[model samples]
Target: MSFGGEAAVIGSRRLFAIHLFTATGAALALLSVLAAWQGDWRATFVWLGIALIVDGIDGPIARRFKVRERLPKWDGAALDFVIDYATYVFIPALVIALGLHLSTLLGAVLGVIVAVTGALYFADTRMKQPDNSFRGFPAVWNMAAFVMFALMPSPAVITIVVIALAALTFLPVNFVHPVRVVRWRPLTLAMLAGWLVASSWFLLTEPPLSAGIKTLLIVTSLYLLCVSGVQQMLPRRPKAGF
Candidate 1:
């Protein structure tokens, strides 16, 4: 075979490997659900966190390797959506139902609301606007549920927040995609790294999250919420693209 042909074959193999790596995230998400089923909340969150990290990094990696261009036969975006729904919506909904220990009636209702709203949000192709900002609240149920669990707030607070978030799913509010938003990418990424550290510490530490870590989580969450809102109000310029 010619050198060009050999290079093409090698590139195809590399792209296939990237696909497999991306798909492993789904496996981790599945494991998180299994952990939740076994009533191991800590293990479940750990697995979910790993899955989140995988999801965060894989997009840039795929772009770097030109996975879509090189392997047009494989739909990485579709695969990502499938796994994302599992980890982001389904498992987190389960966390509310089982881990939170809400009343049977309320738990069932909230779980259905979360799952259905998330499904609808994911199905909306317009979720990601032309400016690369999420047009709605962005169904980040996984992160929301994780923070709620870590904080262990009053059930009433949890219920109110869950309902609010569910309603926000359909609202036309711009939510920043940390990696994709160029104006604040550096600050966003730095805060995200701190959040990961704080989250890991909170998860591993004994229950009833310490004052400092809880404060860290709250601050980080607020930063995300406020930054997204502020960014939406700012005039758009051709800053960067993902």
Candidate 2:
């Protein structure tokens, strides 16, 4: 009956479609969950990978469409956060606890810690800084899980890494959001792209990522982890994310 939709309040169908596109990430997360439950690690990550792509693009697309003005009824950011928690925190926690070298009980406990802390981290109002950099570790368990799988570290080491990263959740360290963080952005994007390439290769091939590819993942992760320190070096006391 109208260009906006069947109802005037429905807003532009084209813009509403973008919000719906963002919502599809939840469906992808569900697929990832099922794949993880089946112990198909590769398939699980593949689904998560697709979901990640969706999460990465939806924001810019929504902005490009001025979705907020066009579709005032829906909150894209909140929807994105909900889908992100599932894909970035919950499912990755599930995969980590499932695939780690630890016993079922211990793994599950770690998963609970990850899930709980990650949820809390997301709720922190200061989670994002003025430059869009994360105020802390950002609870990107998906990447952590990927690194753990690629590295295949010992159980004790894996446990320690998990615990340490969880502890770092509330720390005042900075972590870059590849697409959003601007300083050294070219390098940041390159590292992000390198990670995607290496990880995709690892996923496409058989088990045991090649040493070189694994090395690439590690190097990229290290850059991401320490990039904040680089920023901090510029100013004695970097401005707080708040």
Top-scoring candidate (lDDT):
2
Q: What tens digits encode model 2's per-residue C-alpha lDDT throughout 1-242? A: 57655765554777888989999999999999888778888899999999989988899999987988877788988999999999999998898788877799989999999999999998999988888888878989999998898788998988998899998898888889887877778889999899888989998988767789988999998998888757866754345441
Q: Compose the digit string of candidate 1's lDDT tens values, residues 1-242.
A: 99999999998998898888889988998899889989998899999889888888888899998899889999999999999999999999999987887888888888888999999999998898766778877888888988988887788998998999898788888777877777778888887877887889988778777788888888888777667778778776675442
Q: Which clashing pairs does model 1 show?
A: none
- Work out candidate 2's RMSD over C-alphas: 3.6
lDDT of each: 0.86, 0.87
Q: Look at candidate 2 and tell me the lDDT of residue 39.
A: 86
Model 2 residue pairs with clashes: none
TM-score of each: 0.92, 0.91
How many residue pairs of model 1 clash at the backbone? Answer: 0
